[model samples]
Target: EVMKQPGTNVIEVADAVLAVLPDLQAQLPPSVHLVIKDDNSVNIRKAFGDIRVTMLVTLVLVVGVIYLFLHNASATLIPALALPFSILGAFTVMRVMHYSLNNLSMMALILSVGFVVDDAIVMLENTVRHMEAGESPLEATLNGSREIAFTIVTMTVSLAAVFIPILFMGGILGRLFREFAVTIVSTVLISGVVSITLTPMLCSRFLRVVHAKKGLAGFMDRSFDRLRSGYGRSLRLVLRHRLAMLAVFVGVLYATVKMFGIVPKGFIPNSDNDSLRVQLRAAQGTSYYEMVGYTQRIADLIKQNPDVDSQMANTGGGSGNQNTGRFAIQLTPRATRALTAQQIAQQLRGPLGRFPGFRAFVNVPAALQIGGFRGNSSFNLTVQSLNYDELYAWAPRLEQAIAELPEVEDVSNDMELKSPRVNLIVDRDGGRTWPPQKCQALEGRALRVA
Candidate 1:
């Protein structure tokens, strides 16, 4: 039986099933077997786990660096508090706006970790500077926050300006990124508010003065001071040699342009996931059992790889043709496997390419499948002609030419013209004069031929 949860996510539904799967399997007959044909829940769970790990690691590293520079655990903790507050607050807003906790939003939250802590760190640093100058914590908190309040606001607005345009982009790209951009902008704005309000309050209550000691932290601080001084001196030198600086800037710009032109580009980065969709097509006149046999052989070949967890083959539904079939290959989760779905697909392609009388294409599903974007393959070219014969004649040559391109791989055309047809002709006057049974016999013969 198939079931769906109306208001719950696929991950939740899968978890609910897993909780009872063992018991359910135990009650089944020894000869019967149960298999999940396709489960997107695993992908969702893995992606969420990865995002969580990324956020946690980022927070730890950020806090550790802050403590190293400030040499005070209390000061480090002040900025660290902003990370969760901003993220949780963003979640609250997301819930109210009806956004789910999907990969794009999770990625945005992870990326926002850097920006979310920036305002808090800046405010804390400024407050520490005033404390070092011998001001009381409360006074330093008020004055330091007041000093950088405008700066934080300006930073938030500038970041928002950059991401807000993405919300207005039309089509699949826009739909995929709109949630990501909104999550970032919202978290940054929340962080700004926290920096000026909660951050200063925490600093005033918890921040304390620390005396310098002879250690690695003190040595690093002294080195940083020297670096800042040298940078100031360089700035003054550049101001004095404006023409030389301009020439150097132009040379750097030219180098940047040339480097950009040399870099390879693609529509989307291939995700290293654990599932692949292998589409197979046999010759037009192939029998149903022959197609199934071919698909079973392909499945057997796929199962030879240790990473493969399961395989499901579906025949006779592809483009309404009996010769076409598809294999849904599931592999072990990415953490437990060394090869990605795409890599495994490539490895299998070598053997499948040698399979006689059949053509195969492999692709991983798209990360986000939106309207008009089927996401089944990497690229698609649509050919249209008013004349059917001309279209049929031109399509094969175009397909072959594209297949021969050095950069292209697994090229195939959707236009199939192998179905047999029969034309029926009758003398209208004589047929009208004939008995109805005679006309029926002629129609049956035409249908049999067709």
Candidate 2:
């Protein structure tokens, strides 16, 4: 069984295993056949593709929003150009830092889209305002950039500073989000530079003053004028009632604190990846064939579910004993299925309960599968003690208590305290006095008993 080291990359480990397969196969006896029943790299690749597509969609949507507000192709294009430049600079930083384009980094990239465009948008709007006041594009670019340069620098530094705490966070969260923090910070810094440099240059070259708007542009301008005036009136009224606004702000702050305490906390949120992990366990000391029978029975029931696309069941592999089996169940695409993997697993609990002396655990595979984690479910708890008797005695009570909680389900432990055991003791003096043949005979019997 191959197990990954904690903090190591899953894809890199899988690739290393695959790279040696051909040589390993050649060394094996002709009678032995090698088969790969599961490969996580395939799913990782699929997720990467999906995330890339989502990032592209986010870019397009961000650009569309910019165009809708700006109403001029040249004005919109300046920020659009800045976005890619900022991203490229961020990629360079990622390469330098030896960071992989994993989920967290990709998420940072998606979030950075808005931050990257903001700098350029600010520069473009201010420059266009100068152009509307009858200054030439070159003169407008020079004066507008000079005015906004300090603000851009301050905004960039403040935004990056917000993530500084995340960069220094301790434990697994710190390791995971360090990349996220760095990516956004680098992107923001790059966008700031681009805004102060390339943005003004582009505006000077591409921007043209338009004194009048027509059609959709004219309607949008009129609507924005009304909105700005209404907003001004509301702002003035709120400023006049300073005490009321301060009370409202304090109320919001208190509510935010309360909400933070009330919300459930987790390192990573669950995702529906259209797959489920079904773990089958029989009572300890159960034979491998008996476990196989239980596995097949569960597999048959799982096959009856229309949502299940395919499933593979196996017994006695990896760290599992003869009494344990597992099923890697693939579900149909999310769009075609009415029930999510978690919901289907919950529903299956009823039918799975019909089997006596067997426990079937169903769970969706975590979107972020941390290396070195060996748990049937997303949450794992370990109880450690030097005293075996005390540890075993306490485990069941803890498990039962946890199972009773409304938030927990399918609570189980690996302790096999019910397994039959035999204790053997021998008297040294008695064994020394025994004849050789008799001692040999006793040893043979002990082996048979074992």
Candidate 3:
């Protein structure tokens, strides 16, 4: 029955609720029981925990790859140092922007791992190359930095520019990715600064004078030389057959465009949160007691499945419709349940369909709620008109048409007009002559109706 406000942490709110639960229970009557039928914070914590592990693994792999290529602990350490500085700078910028360590930002940081290291690698490689040519450590560091400083700046600016369009994007996607773009841009800028300022100093202090290669370093150098020679030959062959290469490029472009059209399109990818939502509506004017009975029957039906952990249902309120009932159903954890939430929802459709005068919709909550599009369904279509009669007539027809489409399912509409009612028409002018005593009984009934 509780919903968190937008832009607030679900975990923090859930924690606060847990902290006060004992007192709340003490204040409540013994007949009432409190339960957490659904907790989205569980999903949030698991998702972010995985992301944190990914970030750590990415950092280690990036550093490990640097060590493999450079073959020197000192050489590897310089660029490795850039990672934390750039990441810390990103964190500082995120704090300033009032951003949390949410999914989008974490994903951006993961991608920034590669970008931040690129600048440092470039500076370190150039400096190492100068040292291999017999320059002193200080001289190599200074000359190498001076030579590629402009290139580094240009590369950083160009990389940052790639995400500039995302900042100005509009709507839900824009809002979600704006933080992503800013994080990447800020991380890259900070990395470039670290490469220019910190990387060279570290190289000068840590890098020893070049000596003859003997072991793993020698083997890697030989392997790289062969790769470079092969690449050079391939490049020359492509340049010699420029027309053929152009044709290949055109073919690739055509295939890419074709595949783009063939692929299914969606604004957000589906995710499993180990929960489902059930919304049921009885015929309009159905009494609250009838709805409660229907809700209990449905709940009992769902609970018969061992996978269902708990459900919370309410009738006649919270949904803005007197005839509607809502159930926030929580399933057992994914590891414990044999079937996914979606699959269970599908299985229940047949049994739930047998209920007459009731429409039941089983849906998984959206992975991400954007703007006002937070319904259990994936898409929302709104129809507007100046005439209520026209709207009421067309809405159900449209719903039926959409439901018949092969690509669509679970289509529903909220146009209610069939509620039982009594219509009374009176002749106002003639009523002036009616005797007050004669109308007294009717007036009492009319008051009750009103």
Candidate 2: Cα lDDT at 329: 85
lDDT, candidate 1, 1-450, per-residue tens: 347756677877788887898898999999987778677776778778878888789888988888888888798899999988998899988998799988889888888888988889889989989998999999999999889999998987897788999989988789789988888889989999998999999999999867775688789889899999999999999999999999999999999999999999866777865778888888888898998889888988889999888888889765557888877787887889877888887898898889998988888866654446332356777788999999999999998998899997888877768778767785678768888887787774634453
Output the lDDT of residue 439, model 1: 73
Candidate 2, residue 159: Cα displacement in angstroms equals: 1.0
After superposition, which runs of candidate 3 have C-alpha atoms over 4 Å from their true positions? Answer: 5-7, 26-33, 317-320, 371-376, 420-450
Using Cα atoms with residue i matched to residue i, what is each candidate's TM-score against the true structure? Answer: 0.86, 0.84, 0.91
Cα shift from native, residue 450, model 2 (Å): 5.6
On TM-score, the stronger of 1 and 3 is: 3
Better of 1 and 3 by lDDT: 3
C-alpha local distance difference test of each model: 0.84, 0.87, 0.88
Backbone clash numbers for all candidates listed: 0, 0, 0
Instruction: Write one digit per residue (lDDT tens) for candidate 2, span 1-450.
Output: 588896799899999999999999999999997776566677778788889999999999999999888888888898999988999999999999999898789989999999999989999999999999989999999999999999999998999899888988988778778999999889989999999999999999998756798988889899999999999999999999999999999999999999999998886777887888888778888987788788889988999999988888889756687788888888887789898878998988889978998888888888776676566667888899999899988999999999999988888888878876888776898879898988787774535444
At residue 392, candidate 3 shows an lDDT of 87
Which candidate achieves the best TM-score against the true structure?
3
Q: Which residue pairs clash in candidate 2? A: none
